[model samples]
Target: MPGTRTNPLRRLLVGRVQGVLNNRASGETPVVRSAHALYPPDSVIWRVHGDVTTMMIGGVTALLLQMLHPAALAGVWDHSTFRSDMLGRLRRTARFIAVTTYGERAAAEAAIEKVRSVHLGVNGVLPDGTPYAASDPKLLAWVHVCEVIGFLDAWIRYGERGMSLADQDTYVAQAGLVATALGCDPVPQTRAEAEALVAAFRPALTANARTREVARMVLTQPAPSLGFAPVQRMLMHAAVDLMPPWAKDLHGLHPSAIEVPVVRAGTMAIAQSLQWAFAGRATPRD
Candidate 1:
């Protein structure tokens, strides 16, 4: 049943989501769905990336964590288009992840190479006059580790509470395939390693006006339209709720105890809806 053809509801939901990833008109192909992908379909990376709802929450948490580093913040403050078209920037990011995670291996490699080429032009001096480059392997590792922990934690919390430690490490290592291709040095191949790496970078992290402004825009950017406002708000809350306590402290986000359960339940509702919409469509082994 899991590999059966999609129904109308499935198509409808997917169409809306794909609309953001590709500028192609609805019903036009947005991303490739090769039976031959970068990873075998059974891989943990596929399961985590396939789930739309949790990935949205995880992505926000990753961005929030990433902005804490002044070097990371400097790159965004200098090069990002978030100030004018936040949604477009987010969609492009999502597209990159989707393409790398699910598209054919050649397509995935092309996407990674495109990013590498772009990084070539991204070097600049920070406010403190320290030179920074997106191509720096250490900086690439920071970005990769943040994303690995973010997606893994979000999947465990919202998608599979009973996921095993072995699987968690597997997820980290599986994601490292892409990281290595992108030239991220010291990519963590296990959850424990990922945790340790984040701690190692913590001393270098800080928050100032630039950090707050980026966080505010990331958290409060308007929905694609009014119809999506409530969904966006819940995702923002769930992301904050799932974010590590230390990160929340850095971002000055303190969710009340009363809001925690409410956010969890609402997010679960969204996750379930997504699960249903994707039912019988594809398998991890597809």
Candidate 2:
């Protein structure tokens, strides 16, 4: 009889991959015994957000779109250290989403309070010397809407399954709660409302030197490691593909006709790979 034995290199590789995929070193653990959760277990938001691939791509899309708003971009330019620590910024954002969506009610509220405190300290003069405050409801609304819309768009385009009309609306409404918590007003309660809000606000968005530079940074930022480059590039292109035409044009981020199919295929492949890798890991919150 052959002895049952596992290759040492195979075991080492499996451990390394698991560590990367499930590491909580930065304190982003989902609370298994929280008294309350932001959304219910069976909610559509949980389903859409649970996928790491779509959420990561959606986050890039959100940041790109959010920069189109001068005030929002100005706020970041004046205060954020994104240039020096892009990965840190991404980790922070991912942590916020994780704790808020999956952590207990108390933890989520604490995270919101911490963010509000940070916003109170983030104020500066724009390039035109127009004063800007992160606490402004209007600016907050713009950021919130861009992020929510991006997440929904990515999930819809690249999700494992199609979300129904009602579920889409539910996702928007559910997400609106987080926006409201962050001091955003006129939070869209449905898909139609969200779309209308985006249309109404388009005139206020623009591309400028700063916006273009930031867009470039988002696309060309160095990956955390060499092995991560190809995946990062794929995610960036996927983000561009998911972006609206006007927004993409604003950033001069046109994917060539030949590149479009490649982007779509790569995005789907990445999304599917992530789904397979993380299966049964993130249990839907109850």
Candidate 3:
């Protein structure tokens, strides 16, 4: 058997995975094994954000959850290319996570600042005449919490089977460092608090035409290439299966009882295959 680096099997698996996650040209690549990264290599965030498959599923879940909030949805609706190029939107977000989680301190901080700057311009009136801004502290907090929780939830479901509450809290705290820098106040320090915050935000999260339309695009968007479509479908189903019951219902999405197990099992098989491909590579590409 060839080494992981030169193995055709490894390259093929890793290539296909990257082709989907790195779907668009973002002009930035994640710095692998940087000794000067913001988080240590052994940190919980690195582990949670490192798995490409679960991160994809979690990311979809996060987007769906985030869009339920009118402000978050408004920001994307008014400023983002989500309607025309959903894959580009996904790539930009995935790149941001990759850089912040795996990039060096300067790069991570730069990514944060870029996003903050962009948020300053992303304000608009909601469909109900409510004013909304992406830079609002509470709204930012909502997005942050949804993302971190979604990622952690996916990791527990597919990547790591038995992560403890304490570790999960650690993951939230570690991930919150970026949120704090971005000026999001009241970031949650624990999974319980995060869940509480989600419930608290419920009064503000609404399901409407815009929300349902975005959800449809998220669920039905085409993958970058035909061969990757199956992987994309599997990830979308798993993400839906991973969503909280309330959020799923808000989006008027139904769970396929029969496909749930199949989706999970298929994702597990894909994840394990990628794990094997990157088994001994010094820097596993997520």
Candidate 4:
């Protein structure tokens, strides 16, 4: 049974559809090409970029909705002074991302450790089967830097109007750290190296089997109620409206725009597939 605290509509709004859509294209592309022609290097990079973009967009959209409707966030945004609290949270998140130096082994290790502690399973498996130990500050720093890049991309694509110049600089710095951790020059310097770095690290950046399992469980399990039924309904309505026409048709319902749903779904599927690969897994569960 659905948990009494869970909002069915909200669950549907932020459902597996998002993950499936984000990772679909790239996951399928190789198969499609294997049956026909060799997948071009350019195509692979494009697929990764596309998936990354989709993730940022989805995160941004969810963040915005949460901000607009505190109750929908399931206690993440339920304080009496939610807006101020949220601002503090965003600032801290940004600062965390802004501090890392690129290509620093210490930084990367530090970042990775921090991420492991959260155990969101986004990184898949650690180098060893053991839970990530935060002993190395460098790994933690690098991971934090990469996350900042992800968040920055999301901000530019979806929250550009609200971002400041400081945010852009911070993102650039984080990107530099990502480049450094991957053993590339501070910048890719050339398209080939850029492609190579991306190819090499793509597997490490996404959700792994363990992480996906965690996400799936979190999504499927019901959360406690916070008395925001109307707000939750509104978010659902907005998410549905944001879906593409193809999705609308698939779900047998019309939404605000058909294009967003279609693009978003396709993008998400690819992203999730990449995540699985990074985690060193064969494929994600349907």
Please provide TM-scores, in order, for all candidate models, with all chains considered together: 0.92, 0.89, 0.95, 0.30
**Candidate 2 local lDDT, residue 88:** 76
Model 3: CA > 4 A from native: 23-27, 281-286
| CA lDDT for candidate 1 | 0.83
Q: In candidate 2, what are the lDDT values of residues 184-220, reduced to their tens digit? A: 8888999898888888889988898889898889889
Q: What is the lDDT of residue 135 in candidate 4?
A: 22
Please tell me which model should have the higher lDDT, number 2 or number 4. 2
Per-residue C-alpha lDDT of model 4 across residues 1-286, encoded as one tens digit per residue: 2331165653443343334323343352211111111223233221222332333343333343222211122223222232434323433333233222211345436654564444332232234443332223333333333343344444343324365555455445435544454333334333333334434443344323433332233222221233423332333343434433433343343543565565444544444443433332111121
Would you list the C-alpha lDDT of every candidate in the order shown?
Answer: 0.83, 0.78, 0.85, 0.35
Deviation from truth (RMSD, Å), model 2:
4.4
User: For residues 100-148, what per-residue lDDT tens digits would candidate 3 score against the true structure?
Assistant: 8888789989999999999888889977798988889999999999998
For model 4, the stretches where C-alpha displacement exceeds 4 angstroms are: 1-132, 161-170, 174-199, 203-208, 217-259, 262-286
Q: Which portions of model 1 miss their true places by more than 4 Å?
A: 1-12, 20-22, 25-28, 282-286
Q: List the residue pairs that clash in candidate 1.
A: 41-284
**Candidate 3, run of 10 with poorest lDDT:** 22-31
Off by over 4 Å in 2: 1-35, 283-286
Candidate closest to the true structure, highest TM-score: 3
